[model samples]
Target: MVRAAMESGELAQVAVDVTAEGTDKLFTYLVPRSLAGRLTPGQWVRVPFGGRRLVGLYVGPAERPPEGVALKEIAGLLPDIPPIPAPLVQLARWTADRYLSTFPAALRLLLPTEARRQEVRTLTITNYRLNVDDVEALVSELRRRAPRQAELLAYMARVGGEAERAQVLADLGESIAGPIRVALEKGWLTAGRVARRRDPFADEHVEPAPPPVLTPEQEQALASIRQELIAPPAFRQPVLVHGVTGSGKTELYLRAIALVREMGKNAICLVPEISLTPQMIQRFRARFGGDVAVLHSALSAGERFDEWQRIRRGEVSIVVGARSAVFAPFENVGLIIIDEEHEQSYKQEAPPPAYHAREVAAERARLEGALLVLGSATPALESFHLAQTGVYRLVSLGHRIDNRPLPPVTLVDMREELRAGNRSIFSRALVEALDQTLSAREQAILFLNRRGYNTFIMCRSCGGAIQCVHCAVALTYHLGDDHLACHYCGYTAPVPSVCPSCGSDKIRHLGAGTERVEQELQRLYPHVRVARMDVDTTRRKGAHAAILKRFADHEVDVLVGTQMITKGLDFPGVTLVGVVLADTSLNLPDFRAAERTFQLVTQVAGRAGRGDRPGRVIVQTYQPDHAALQAAAEHDYHRFFAEEIRFRQELDYPPFAHMIHLVISGEDEAAVAATAQNVHRVLAEGGFGGQILGPAPAPLAKLRGKYRYHLVLKGPDVRAMAAEVKACFAAARGKWRASRSVSLSVDVDPVSIL
Candidate 1:
C-alpha cells in the first residue's frame, strides 16, 4: 500500500511565486515520495508548469489531483532553506486581501532579492587551481576566440578562486554577459550558488557607544511596557510612547530592548527612513554590539541577504532598520519598537500591499506575543485616538533628559521682515542668531524642505512660471549647475537668461531652498565651514551617514538640509536651528499637511538645546498664527491634537472614518477619465453608502506621460466599504480587460489624496 501510494505521488497545493494579480491562486502539484514528509507548508519548491520551471511556496496537502489533467511532479526542493514561519505566511495573505494586492507581492515584502533568489544556480569559477600550470594554456586558447572571457579569467585568477557572476559582469560591463555564458558552456566555469560577501560598513570604523542612564520619565515608561510584556500572550495592548523631543525616548527603547533580549527573546526596532538607519544602528550596535543586525533599503542586496542569514541563524538578538525590518525572521520576538512612529516614510506608497509598518508591527506583536512600543514626539492622529479609546495604552515623557529645557522658539513673520526692508531670505533675527552662533563657534542647523537653489522662476513681465515640459509642477532652478530641473520627473534644461514666455529678460528666481540657504550661509559667514545635507548631496551610497558623521565631529559649523535632518539626530554642539520657511509643508495639498508641519517644527526644534547650552529656534513663516505653528511653538501636543482631531472628524478623515483613494491612470487622458467614471458608476450602483468624491483630475494629473484621475471614498466602516470597492474595481477591470490600456490602484487609509 505504501509503495503504491508513493508511486502515485503525494499531491501538494502550492502558491506559485509570480507577482501578477489573478495569478496568485493555488495550484496542485505532485510531490515525489522521497521529499513527501520533508516538504512542509511555507517551504519553497521548484515546480514544472506549462513546460517551464518556476519557484513556488508549498501551501499544504491537496485533497485530490485535478479532475481531468495529470498532475506535474515537483521538480526540486530548495536545499538548506528553512520554511517561512507559518504566522508570517498568514500575515502576508491577510495583508494581500486587505490591501487589494496579490499574495506574491506581499510575499516579496517578506523575502527580499537574495532570500528569494538564493535557491537559483549562480555562476562561479570552475575547480581550476590558479597555482597549476594549466591556467596559461586555458587563457591563451580563450584569448584567441573570446578576448573578454580571457580577460575575465585573468581578472578572476588575480582576485582569487571565485567571484559572483553578477558582480563580475557588473564590474566588467554587460558586454561580458555573453563571455560568461561562453565560459560556462566551455567548462571553464561552473554554474552554482556561491556565498556572497556584503559588508556595507566594511570601510568605516565603528566604536562602541555606552548606553546612557535612564531618566525617571524613561524608567516610568519602561515599567509600563514591562507590565504589558508580562501579560497573557498576544493580548497585551500596544503602548504609545508620547515623548517630547530629547525626552529620553531612545533610552526607554534601549532599556526595554535589553530586558527582552535578557529574557532570551529577540526584538525588532524600526526607524522611518534610510537616513535615520545609520545613527540608530550606531546606538544599537553600541549597546548590543555584534548581536545587532541592520536592515534597510540602502544596504546592498548581498548585505541585506547576509543580515537576513544572521537573523535566521540566531546570530543576532536585535534587528534595527527601516519599515521592512518588521518582517525580520525572528521565531521568538519579545518586543517591537517603532521610533519616529508618525513619519510618513513608514507607509509603503507604491507597488501594492501598501502596509504601514506601524500596522504590521502591531499585528506582528499581537501574533508573536511581543510588546509593541510606538515612540513619537507627535503620534499619528489614529494611533493617539486608539490610545484614548483604550485599544492602546499611552505613556508620556514630558521633559527633556538631565533637566534640559525645551528650546525657546520665536516665529519671525517673513512679511514683517519684508516690511522692515530686510529683503534677504533670512529674517533679521535669524541672521543675527546665525552670526552669533558662528562667532561663538557653536554649530547651527538650517532646514528648508525644498532642495534646489530656487523653488521656481517666474517672469516679471508675463507673470508666467517656468515649468517642466513633462510634469505639471514648476521647474526648480539649481545654482551650481545653472539649470532648471523638475523635482518630480528629473527633467533638466539650462536656465533661460530671458523668460521663455513673452521673451522677457526679467526672470525672477522666487522661493528659498536648502541650496539657496547654504549659499546664503556662505555669503554671510565666509570663515565658517558649512555642510549641506539634501537629496542632491546625499544621492550616493553611505553619503547620508558620511555627511552626518562629519557634522557630528564638528567638521562643519552649520548644516543645511531638508526634512532628513529634522529627526534622529543627537548632536550636542548644535545650539541653533533655523526653519528657512516654516510654511513650506503647511500649504501642501493634503489633509495631514498641518499635522506634518507641526511634527517637523517640533522635531527640528528638539535638535536644538539637546546639549548643555540652551538652544534657540527661528521660524520664518508667512503664516505665524497658523494653528500648527502656534501649537508647535508652544510645545503643546494636546492642544494641537484637540484642534486637529476636530477638523479631522468634521472632514471625515481617519480616526473618525476610513478613506480609500483610487487613482486611474493611462497614456490616453480620455481613456483614464472614462475608466474612472466607470468605476465611480459601478460603486454607486453597488449601493455603497460611502461618500464618493471626484472623478476629477488628480493634483499630478499628468505624470510620466500618463494622465491621472482620482476618486476618494470615505465612510465609517472601512472593511465593508473595502469589499464593495474591490468588487466594483473587479467589474471595471473585467470590462476594461480587452484593451487593458487603463490601470488603477486602491490605497486604503491613504496618507495623501494627491
Candidate 2:
C-alpha cells in the first residue's frame, strides 16, 4: 500500500500567497507528468491566498511537499513560456525583506499577466531565405513596388534578415502580412517568432556617462565615503550630508551612485514626493542609461509593473522614485540616497503603519550592508544629532557648487509694517524691493507659507459665520468660488448668505491667502505678470514643472506660492525672495513646530539670488522675536541649533532620547480613545517605562472620517521602546478586535506629531 505514496516520482504544483507571511514559502500539490510540461516558474497561477482566489507567481520546485492537506493544482501557467530566471527570484527576496512585505507581493509587483485582458495580435508575413541573390533581387523590387514591404525588408536587412513567422505576423497585423508574403515568396525574407513589445517605450534607454563635478568639500566627503566602502562592509553605515541650500549634495550622490554601478551593483534614489521623481529621474537618466527605472504614483499600473520587472531582471541599474522606491527590487544594492531627506514628506501622513521613509531606509541599508546617504540643506534635528554624536558620519558640503554667497535676509516685523497703516502683509520696504527687482529684469518669488491663511469669515452682527458639520475646525471662505471649504476633510458648500449661528447678514471674508496676495500685487504692479503656485495650481501631473519652467524662463515677473515653492526650485534670475509669513508652521501644537518653522524659514529665505546677482530676502512675520525666526533670518544654524538642542535635551526629546509615536485611529471616537488608553496602560504594565506622553486627541483629531489619538513614547533605548510597542499592539489586539470600530497605527522614529 506504500504504493510509494506514489507522489515520489510525480511533478508537484505549488501556490504561494501574496501576503507578507506566505510569500517566502509555497504550498505544494501533487501533479502527474502529463501536466508538467504546461507549468513553468515566473508564470502566474491561480491559488488560494488568504482565503481568496489570488494569482500567485509560479516559483520553482517546492522545497518540501505539503504533508496532509489536499493541495490544488495550478490551473495553468501564464504565457505557456520559458521558465522564470533565477536572478529575479533573488531580487524578489531582497525587496520583500527590505519593505517588510511578502515575497509573493514583491513578485506580483514585478510580474504582470494579460489573463484578464482582451486578446490582441499583430499579423506580419514572412519568408525563409531560400536564396541570398534571389532575396536581394526581391528586396530591390519590393523597396520600389511596395513601400510597406520595403520597410520590413530594411529592418530584416539591418539585423541580418530573418523574417518573423506566425507571432510576428499576428503582431504586425494581418493586412501587413499579405504584402510581406509577396516579398517572402520572392525570397526577400525568412520567418521567425518573437514576443511583441508590450510597451512601445519599454527598453528606451541611454548610455551611462561620467558624473557631474563636485566642489572641493564634496570631493573630500566622497573620498571619506570611498574609505568607508573600501573597509569591511558594515550592515549599516549612514552618512548625513548637511550643507547650505544650493550645495552640491546631489552631485556628490551622483558620483557615489556611479561608483556603485561601476562596481556591478544597483542603487535607489528616493525623492520626497511624486512631483520630484520626474526631475530626479531625468538627472539619473541623463547620467545613467535607459535602464534607470522610475516609480511613482503618476505611473500607470502596467508601466510600473513593467519597470519593476525590468529592475528584477537586472536590466535596471538605478531606481529613482518617491517614498515607495525605498523598497525597489534592485539586486546588489550598494547605495541608497535620500535627497531632501529631512523633508516632512518622508513621513507618510496617512495609511496603516505610517512609517517614515528616512528611518526605514536606515533599517533597510543596515540589513543589506548598503551605504545610506541622507542629504538635506537643513537636516532634521534627529539626523543632525546622529551625525554629531557619531551614530552617523557627518559629511559637509560647505559651499554652494555655484560658489554663490548666501542671500542677504532682511526681517520686517508685522507690528512695524502695521505702524505704517498699510496692512497688506507686504511691507512698503518689500514692495520697493519687489518693484526694483522686477524692473531690473530679475524674477521675484513671494513666499506665503499658509495656503488659506489664519483667515476666517465673520458676521459683524453675530461674530460667527460658519463651521464644519462633522469637525471642530472652522470653514475657510474661498473667494475664487463662492464656497465654504473644510481643509481638514474637504467638506465644501456654497457660501451661506447669512450666519448660521444668528441669521446675521453681511459676512466678511477676513485675512489673506496666496490668492489675496496675488490680487493685491497685480493691483499695485499691473505691468508685472504674477503666477500663483500652490495646491490649487499644481494638482495636475506636469503642472509644477510647467510653472517652474515659465518662472525660470522669465515668462512671469513675480511668482507667488505656498511652501510648495521651496522644493528643489532652482532659478538664478530670482533676485528677491519675499517671505510674507515666516512664522507660518511655527504656531502648530507640536514640539517639532519650532524645528519645522526654522527649516522652512531658512530654506525659503535661501532662495534669493542663488545666481551671481547676489540675491536679497525680505521676511515678514508676526514673531520676528522668536528664535527660529531670528536665527533663520540671519542664516545662523549654529545659534538656532544650540537653542533647539538645549530645549530637546531638557525635554528628553529626540537627540536626547528616541521617540516612537503610537497613533490609534478608527471611525468610532470612543473606540480610538479607548485603544490609546489601553496602549498607555499596557506600556505601564510592561514596566519598560519610556515616558508615556499622550492620550491626547491628535491635532487633527478627525481626518477622513477617522478619529485619531496618539502616544509619544520617549526613551534612551530605542530597541526596548520598539519591543514595548510591539507588546502593546499584541496585548491590545484581542480587546480591540472584538469591536469593529478599533484599530491601531504605530509609527517608529516619527518625524511629526501630527
Candidate 3:
C-alpha cells in the first residue's frame, strides 16, 4: 500500500507558518519517496516557499497538484517533536473559520512558544555507570592512593551503580572530575549521554493527600459529571457547574477527573490566571503525583518545552495550566475543566485568532467525544443563558463545604463618610474594621484594582492632568520609583516641580491605588506587616507565590493587591476582606461593566469568613444604591443576572446578539478615520443585514502612539458576518488600496471593546 501510494505521487497540502495576508490558505507540495510512509496529517515539516525554507504543518494529501504548477518537495520532518493530533488540526481550522483568523495563526496556538520557533531541543546530560566486575576490590585498592576516587566509586555504587554526571559531582565534590576521568580512561566506569527533562517543580515536595468526604451538593454535581463521562450524548451538552465560593467546586472536578482516568483517558484543567497555577498544581500534584504536568507563561522556555514534550508523549494523564491548556495533546481526552469560566483572561485579545477558551473547549469536546465541565462561582452571562435554554446541563452547589455561613457584606457609603468630615481614603467603617481585625491578630485582604501610588497627577491651577505622550490616558504616579508611568504603555517621566500647562507649583496627586493603601495601612498601624501584590511588585518570577506564601503563613497582617487576589485564593487566616473602592470597575464605558463589577466584588467578598471564626467584608462605594452592588452585598447571583440580562437584551448586547469589533489604527489620525469610514461603507455596500453602530473614535481613542477608530457590527450570527467581512475586504482591495500606514484588527465576540 505504501508503494502504491508513493507511485501515485501524492501531493501534500501544507499550511506555511508565514502570516502574510495572501498566504492564509494551504499550498500543495510533493512528498518525497522516503517520507511517503512517515508523513501524516498534522506533522510539522520543512518546505520551500518563495526561494526560502519555512516550517509548515502537513494537512494531509491534496487530491492533485495545482493545474500547470510545479510543487516543491517536503524538505524534511521536524525531529524529536510529535505530530499534533488530527483533532487539534481540525480544531485549528474551525477556530480560524469561526474567529476570522488565518490558518497559520490558529495552528500556532496548538504549539509551545519555544517549540514553534524551533529554539529548543531534547536536553541531554552525561551519565556515568560502573562497568567493572569487582567494584569492592577496586575501591579498596584506590582508597589508600586516592581517597576522592574511592569515595566517588563508592558513592556511585551506593546509588544503584549509575548516576548522572552532575549528581555525582554534587554528591562527592568538584575535585572528583580528575578521578572520574581516570576511572573512565582505565575502563572502570563508562559514560553515556541520556535525555534529561527539565522539571519546574524540582525544588518543591508534594505529599500525597487522601480524598476527603464530599458534601451532598458536591456529590450530586460529581454524579452529574460522571454520568456524562460514562455515557455522553450524541450531541453532548456541556456541564455548567455554578457553585458559590468555598463550595468545594474544585473537589468535584478532581473526582470527575479520577473517573475519566479510570476509563483509560486523559484530562485538561484550565485556570484563568497564572497566579492560580502554583496552588492548583500543588493540589493536583498532591493527588496525582508526577502524573500532572503544568504549562503557563511564568515557566522558563526550557521548562515549557519539556512540559509540552511530556504531555505530547502521554507521560502525564492530567494537565493543569492557563487558557492554552485547553489544546492539550491527548489522543483520547475524556474531560476538560475550566475553573473560572467568566474570567476575561480566557479570551485572547491580541495576535489575531482572539478565541475564548470556553468556546474552544466546547468544540474540542465535541470533536473528541469528551465531557466539558465549566465550574465558576460567577458564570458568564452567555453561559447562564445557554443553561437556561436547556442547551447545557446545569448543576448547582449552593452551600459551602461544611455549610459555613456566607460572609456578611457591609456597603459603606463613602459619600456619607465625606459629609461626616472623614476625608481619608478609607471610610470610617473600613478603618474601624481593619483596626479590630489587626487587634485580633487576624489577617485581612485589601482589594484595590488600581496598582500605582496615584491614578493620575493633575494641576489644581489649570485643571490639566499629566498624560502619557504615547497614549491618551493619564500617567499614574508611582511612589516607589518617584516617577510618573503610563500603565498602558510603560512610558515613564520625572516628576515636574511645576505644572506644565500653567507654570504653577500646584500639581497634586489624585486617586488612591494599592501603593497608597499599603502606605496608609502602615501609617495607621505602625508595626503592621503589609505586603502588596500587584503588577508592579509581582513582575519577577515566583513573586506571586512568594507573597501568597507570606500571607498563608500569617506573616502578612494585611495583603493589598489588585484583581490578582480576587479569585482562586483560599486562606483560612483571612477573616476580613475590604474593597477600598467597589465603584472602580462599575464606571467603565463598556457594556459588561456591571457584570464585571458584580463578579469582582462577589469573588473578593467570598474570600472572607472561610475559617472557624466568622468573616466580614466591608465594601466602600460611592454608588451605595447601585443594583449590582446591592445584589453582591446580598450574595444573590440570580438577582444580578436577571437585571444585567434584561439590560443586555434591551441594548442587544452580547448574550442577545453576537458582535464583531473592527479597529483601525495608525500614527496618522486622518488615515485611521478615513480607513474606518471606508470599512463601514464596504460592509454596508456588501449587503450586511446587521446593525452597524460606529465609525467613530473608540472609547480609548489613542493607544500606544496610535489613533484608534472602531466599528461594531451586531447580529445573530457571527460566522455569516465573518464571511461577509472577508468578501467585502477582498472586493475592495483593488478599488481603494489600503494604505501601508493604517492597520485593521478584527475581534469576533470581543470580551471588551476598550
Sorting all predicted structures by lDDT, with the top scorer first, yields 3, 1, 2
lDDT of 3 at 732: 81
Between prediction 1 and prediction 3, the one with superior lDDT is 3
Q: Give me the displacement of residue 626 in model 1, in angstroms.
A: 0.3
The C-alpha stretches of model 3 lying farther than 4 A from their native spots are 1-10, 68-70, 143-150, 274-277, 734-738
For model 3, what is the error of residue 26's alpha carbon versus the real structure, in angstroms, after optimal superposition?
1.1
The reply for model 1, stretches above 4 Å from the true place, is 1-6, 48-52, 117-197, 203-210, 274-277, 497-504, 731-733, 736-739
lDDT of each: 0.84, 0.71, 0.90
Query: How many residue pairs in model 2 have overlapping backbones?
Result: 22
Q: What lDDT does model 1 reach?
A: 0.84
Q: Please give the TM-score that candidate 2 achieves against the real structure.
A: 0.82
lDDT per residue for candidate 1 within 1-754, as digits (tens), equals 3454447668899988776556768888877776867778888888877766777889899987779976777888876456788888887887877777788788877766565776432223423222324666778887888788788788778768567666786779989878777767777766675454465667755687777778878888889999988888746888999999988888888889989988999999998784464777777777777888889888877678778767877888999888888888778999999998989999888888888888888878877778889989999999999999999899999999888999999999999888889999988999899888888889999999999998999999999999887777889999989898988889999999998879999999898788899888889888888999889998898789889989989998999999989988999999999998988889989999999999999999889989999999999999999999999999899999999999998887898998888999888888888888887788898677899999899988887668889999899987778777777756655674223788888888888888
The TM-score of predicted model 1 comes to 0.88
Name the better of 1 and 3 by TM-score. Answer: 3
TM-score ranking from best candidate downward: 3, 1, 2
- The deviation in Å at residue 504 for candidate 3 is 2.9
Error of 1 at 665 (Å): 0.7
Q: Per model, how many backbone clashes are there? A: 0, 22, 0
RMSD of each: 7.1, 5.5, 2.2
For candidate 1, the clash count comes to 0
